[model samples]
Target: MKAYIAIKYHINLENKELIEEISNALEVNKIKSCCIIRDKEEWGRKTFSVEELMSISFKEIEISDFIVVDLSEKGVGLGIEAGYAYAKGIPIITIAKEGKDISNTLKGISKKIYTYEESSDLVNYFKRLKETSIIHNSI
Candidate 1:
């Protein structure tokens, strides 16, 4: 399975670590994950036009089994990605830090939402989901 991780382009250290943790958790479950920022770095690409980026992202979302979106911080691009994934009939797993306010529009499209105090909460949840075969069958 493959997951497209949608997150704010400009993130703090905490959010960065959270993305890393999420990636690690997905790896343990044998799920391949991708995101724009990481892909750009891996490709050694310095710049891309907005249209180019969106084209790439849309292609990635189209091929992914599901999407994992971090909504702790609001961003137009995040919403766009979630909306595109939803339109493509792809499952969305939304996550946010405890106490962060998420827009109703996002919640409406999410298959599951996790409000976590620690990143480990997400890791454990993914483990449980994999154990129950939810990730494989449902997603």
Candidate 2:
């Protein structure tokens, strides 16, 4: 099934190697994934109007069966995308570094919240998520 990964843009710009590891994990678990920052071709084009761009993004999130929100850092865009996915009836999985405080607002909307100390934590979680239907259908 298709999944959209909502992550901070800075993660892409700075720690791309880590993102690659995450991508590998997703692929190993049999999920087709897309990330806005990693897929520059999806949004790097010039001359697109704001409305058009938003529509494209919204469409992607809507098409995905589920969303994975990386709460490793504070991100306005990530929060908005996760909220949009939640509103659209898509299951959401939220993950952050151990000891980080995730807002209750986000917890209420997510099907599951994982606190990770390393990439392996996320990788293992994704592996499990793929093998079972743990999605919470309620809004």
Candidate 3:
């Protein structure tokens, strides 16, 4: 089973590296992502667009078995995606940077939030999430 990962793209040049680093981690782990990129028709920042696109993305994500989120930046969009996935009855896997705090909206998620200090941490967390999702679907 595949998973859709929601991540925030930091607009700052310095933080853009952070976005790419995190996105690469998702690809390396083979978790499908809900990241939005440049397009003439697309307006607003990547994370900001989540509020507008959550329902649409949720339909695509629901095609898969689970949803994983990167809440390192604590963007509102990640929260929107997480909530949508939760409401859709899909299991949620949250990945947060080691020093970051899980937002109030995401704090109460029943499943454990995998915390990562580096890209490697993200990779390992995704592996665990994938295996758990596979087992969950089998039952």
- Name the best candidate (by lDDT): 1
Rate residue 98 of model 1 by lDDT.
94
TM-scores of all predicted structures? 0.88, 0.84, 0.69
Q: What tens-digit string does per-residue lDDT give for candidate 3 at 65-124?
A: 667677777667777778877777787777777888887668686366777777667666
Winner of 2 and 3 under lDDT? 2
Instruction: Tell me the tens digit of each residue's lDDT in model 2 across 9-110.
Output: 652367565566667767878887887656643333433465764676788898788888878777787788988998888988888888988999999998
Clashes of each: 0, 0, 0
| Candidate 3 deviant stretches above 4 angstroms | 10-16, 38-52, 131-139
Local distance difference test, each candidate: 0.83, 0.75, 0.63
Q: Write the per-residue lDDT of candidate 1 for residues 1-139, one digit (tens) a residue.
A: 8999998865333456667887887788788899787776443345677899899999999999999998878889999999999998898889888999989999999888888898777778877777877556755
Candidate 2's C-alpha runs over 4 A off are 42-52, 136-139
Q: By TM-score, who's the top model here?
A: 1
- Pairs in steric clash, model 3: none
RMSD of every candidate to native, in Å, equals 2.3, 2.9, 4.1
Overall local distance difference test of candidate 2: 0.75
